[model samples]
Target: MTQAIPTPQAAINAVAEATQQTPRKITIAMAQYSQLPIGRPFGCFANSVRHIAHETGAEGRTPQLIAFPEMHLFGTPGMTDDERHTMERSAATDLHDELSDNFAALAKELGVWLIPGTVCEKNPGGYVFNTMPVYAPDGTLAAAYRKICPWRPYEQYTPGTSLTTVDLPGFGRLGLTICYDAWFPEISRNLAWMGADLIINLVRTTTPDRAQELVLARANAIANQTFVLSLNAPEPEGYGSSLLVSPEGDVIAAMEGATPGLLIRTIDLGATRRTQEHGTLGLNRIWHQFHPEDLPVPLPLYGGRIDPQSWHPRHTAITAT
Candidate 1:
């Protein structure tokens, strides 16, 4: 028989209790892959999650969190309106129902929190949003964060408006952000202000920008004085540079390229606290120390008449003749 999902509040409590105690060691799993058949990715994702946890646990290290890349379910672009609608209606099974249950069950069974990165979520607006849902160890939903900014060519997705964080019992406060959102510094600052000690960046990106972005992740961690777990998908869909950066901007664990596997490492939350306490001078420095206002804005590349198609095709042909 299956078990019931816990209320959001209960899930919050479960996480809060887990973080409050000591020893502060946690393992994060990042699964990298390309686009697969519709709904086929979930099976692979589940297997990867289970395998990573088992391997880490075998090493006597319990995985407190497991994270995947953005839009792990719906694959990449190519859905028509009708197909999108179908996906929206069947979201429970296709997107969350089974995955949530499995992760919750796994979290309960393995005693670890699962951050399944961002999934394709159908909102009431008839558009899908990239959203991340966090599961506590007790088979409960702790928190969910939708991507605030959608990348180019994905203007169809609805943007999220709120910034939220969840308290994890043994991990301190946790914040979630997906792919493109990491490029925006304000989002990370806001989460830090909200008391987030650990931020999980779930991404699916391509090269030749992968190495550069990995550096950015480390910079964000050092600036925020918090732990950053950047979980990315494998190529050709994404450049796999899954990394765990410490509060002082040290790369604790990382994996490069489209290799299908997991990178397990121990993170000491106490070190984060220590960095924040003793490194206040470095941490408190303003980001834009240089006067950005001194730079002038560039002119527009093109300026043309508003109505370019006003001339009829027949008239243009007659003029040419």
Candidate 2:
């Protein structure tokens, strides 16, 4: 039988204290996903997670944590509401249900923490929300975070109101945020303020301006002085820039667009602490230098009124349903 993993609170305190002494090396696994069927997606995710864990171990490094991209098990991007709902239901995995249990079993078997990036959750409101579930090595549920922000035309989906952070046995406080949430600086900054040492962003973004958004993500890490693990979807809708950024804004590991593979990296918590204590590189300097009031105001381009029916080509011949 496998040993039981410690609870989240206990793990957090232990890892936080460990950071003051020796630098604990934690492995972050990023899995990229392509548009595929439900079974294929789950299989691909499972293989990638297991492979990365084994490969890192073979490299003489024990992987303490593995993370996958947003909606890795279930494919995203359906055209209509009915289609989307059907896909979501077909691909949805219950948190304490069978699918979650499968991942829990994987964590137990591998003895590694698993952050299954974001899964499509069936909410009570007859809508689906993107959620992230963290599992302990002993196959226990550690934490779950729902995406606070949903993308455009996704108003039909329920919005999440809470942010969550959990502790891993070998890793420090881990924060969870989904794709669209990364676009909101307040979310990450608040997590940092709440004592999160690492922020995991699971994304499936297909926008043309994603590269620019990555710059913002790096800024969040630099400004917060915390490690960031961002995993992106591989293809068909996502421009994969899956990456790991250090507290000082260094791109430690980055994968190019739509690449289906695992990107593994070791994070040193002590280094992050030292950088903060020195008051030269991390949050200390940012606190001393930047002020919110000093920021420039965003100018309004077009009027507040938006007539989608008049401007949108898709709505040109549409009638209200």
Candidate 3:
């Protein structure tokens, strides 16, 4: 059964109890790969992961967590809306099953925690979702999260309603989100508020937007006082600025915009705790200030695709043709 997280005060207590002993060093592997064709074979990518794991898992140090970019399995980087829709339907039916199985096997062989990016997941009801699955070292399906917000109007993938976090035994708790989900600060903040020590945001963004994505991720890390890993694909179609950010808002390790290789870094969780304890804004204080009173929650109705007005009142229309 999944562990139920308590309120903010309880979360702080959990962190305090968990941090009694000196935290162990966790080696993270950020596997950067070039974007492939829409219908590429899953085995090709699985083999690539196996090879990288073999190479990195040699000698004394092996990565504890290995992450890949979102939509790493099949992508339509330069497709028209009609083309993308058609391909999405075809790939959802053809590829999701085989690829998911291979990822499980790969994780078991590697003996490491794996987040093998997002894939087109077909539900029993025929709705498709962009889902990211987390695999434990023994090949068990630890946790999975569907992309809460797909990329604007371009991808019409189904959005998931809930969030999930995975526990890494002795290491710490981990939060997983895919692609555009990072754009919403609420997602990462909720994760951290729930006692997640690390938040991993996977993406397949373009080169021009890489810098913006990095800054967004960095801010998320600093605000939450948690380590953030933003893993992205390689250029030219995809910018490979896969990043690992410390709780102090520092970029600990990152890949170049066009590089395709593994970035391995050993991080200590003590720093994450230290940052939380001595934060610029005290989390405990803020939590208490907002918690006692009965408050009404407001839900805004008209900002996104649901808006009846197509034209922007303040700016020029930038909708894709």
Candidate 1 wrong stretches, greater than 4 Å? 1-23, 33-36, 41-44, 57-59, 76-99, 280-321
In order, candidate lDDTs are 0.66, 0.70, 0.73
Model 3: CA > 4 A from native: 1-21, 57-60, 77-79, 93-96, 280-321
lDDT of 2 by residue, 77-157 (tens): 555767866777767765878789888988998888887767778755666777899899999988888789988675345
Better of 1 and 3 by TM-score: 3
Better of 2 and 3 by TM-score: 3
lDDT of prediction 1: 0.66
lDDT of 1 by residue, 233-316 (tens): 786667787888887688887886666556767666655554554453332333233243344433354343222232111101
| Per-candidate clash tally | 12, 0, 0
Candidate rank order under lDDT: 3, 2, 1
The segments of candidate 2 whose C-alpha lies over 4 angstroms from its true place after superposition are 1-21, 39-44, 57-59, 76-81, 125-127, 282-284, 287-321
**Residue range 120-161, candidate 3, lDDT tens digits:** 777887788888889898988898888899986877888898
